[model samples]
Target: MRNSTIDLLKVLASQIIVIHHLLLYTPMSPVLQAEWPALLGLIADEGRYMVQIFLVIGGFLAAQSLLGLLGKARDVAVWPLFKKRYLRLAKPFWVAIAVAVLLGWLSSKIAMHSEISDLPTLAQLLAHVFLLHDIVGVEALSAGVWYVAIDLQLYAVLVLIAWASQKTGQLKFLEPAHALLLLASAMALASLWMWNRNAEHDEWAWYFFGAYGLGVVAHWAQRESKIVLSSLLIACVLGIAMWIEWRERLLLTGVTALLLMNSAQIERFVTLIVQGPVRWLGDISYSVFLIHYGVLVFASSVVIALGLTSVAEMLLAFVATWVVSVAAGWVLHRVVDR
Candidate 1:
């Protein structure tokens, strides 16, 4: 069966993130508040957490997929594997960066209603182009680029972790119980280190490398061993703790769910929800992630052009943004994802 739960989580996470962006277009500034802004802040903050969920899923799938490839191949070359992973992440990434930069630059100069300063400048753009900005704690050129950097890092981390596992005879032993404990200890120490570091920075790094690695650990644990509740608990606690800052909270949430092993409640609900148009959105979720902001900015401009300043027009602008952007994303995905 498909990983329906993860699919549902991906869809849910994207919607939460998009809605969060929608809120920013309005005057409901949740992050500016001291006390929690209840649903608004929670929902808006979901962009980060949802991305973490994506990371966790990506890490597990990437590693598992690579392992399968290696198992089937007699003499696996590292360069090809690395290149494959890089292309998978980097191709759409290249398009996304170019488009985001162009849109941000254009909106900054030409578009009347826009928020392009949030995007990177030339120097920052270079850092992002090289995929090294987040490494040195530099901000992204675009709003959501740190995640890109993190995804790349997690790719390398997964490779190293898998390599080490095979070399150390851990993969051969398949005594998942022992591996689970060792991983648990490692994650605990990492969490402690993060807690000691700046929470904000730690949040970003953890989401990038730490959380995804933890997911890899979980997938390995589940596949190689019977079942373990401890990993889930750890991921859960970390996720709840992450609500204060990083998006890795959502990754931790995925890990928590994965640890549950079997849950009818989640399985049935997820299957039902991911039906029809919702699943169609899942197919175009990448569009929602990449072009939604650009579409929203343009749609706002269109509303202004039409001289339709009503609340209904604002709502229409938002809906039209998703519709148009999703179509563009589908066409773009076909061309660029190759």
Candidate 2:
């Protein structure tokens, strides 16, 4: 059964991210900016924060899926789980990369724009194939590809932690599940207090583990019916972190975690309200995330080549691009992601 609330979050966050990239990377944004600088600036500045929602949701789902394994057996099949995760993330991802590279080449021939990625060297392409583009200092063929790599890394870390917990049951006091929770919480705190504050670590999963960990904890809280304690601890930790140094991203992460902790209560209401088009959007959100950049590059290049420079024309082009992105996402979902 699909969680409507999670779908709603995915739908909203994916659209915002698409718009953020459109504004940040496309040539048409300059014309829109001239007309509504404040609005465009606000989105361009803060829209990237929506990624926190995805990170939290990723961790939440990861925990949810692993709960069965953690509950049933003394040992997790770590390699199998990791392999499944990698294939689930990488299969559609590689397809999207091919689409992006081809579109980038086509876009360049139409108009030379910074959004169009240069031809990737064989090494760079291989790095991308292994999801090591960012770690290896290779340029990504598409925007936001780094997130896919980090998502896989974070899942791997969680899987290893769970496996370790099972092995370390020698700790007479703590059960494997409890130990897993404690270790995850400790890592979250370390990330919130130390790693996340350092920009240098942004490419790594540890830097974003705070937000991701909250989701993991939230899942356990919901499952164990310890919501109050879990919520309070999360709130206090995030509050203190923010008090020391305010970050809107962290604030959003905390909010997302709280909402997810209480998702069961509101799932029915959310499902009632979020239907039809909204549901479809959420269903294809991942596809949109993977394919929108390529569509945007193609759309923008076409607009530029045709000399659509007026405010009205550019605005229309932007709308057209957004619509095409969604449509393309639906197609990708149907063909590849399903």
Candidate 1 per-residue lDDT over residues 1-338, each given as its tens digit? 56566666667767777777766763223232223467666766555666766766665666566555445543335567667776776677667767766665565554466455465657776676667776666665445656666676656655554444445443477533344335533653465335424556542434345546555555555555534564556556566556655544544555543633332336776777778777766766665576566655555555555666455555566566656767766666778863
Relative to the true structure, candidate 2 reaches a TM of: 0.97
Q: Rate the local accuracy (lDDT) of all candidates.
A: 0.57, 0.90
* Pairs of colliding residues, candidate 2: none
RMSD of each: 5.1, 1.3
lDDT of 2 by residue, 1-338 (tens): 67888999999899999999999988889899889999888898899999999999998998887766778864688899999999888888999999998998999999888788788899998998999999989888899999999999999999988888887676667677887888988999999988898989988999999999999999999899999998899989999888777788998898899889989988989989789999999999999999999999998889989998899998999999999989989998999888
C-alpha TM-score for every candidate: 0.75, 0.97
Indicate the residue-level lDDT of 118 in model 2: 81
RMSD of 2: 1.3
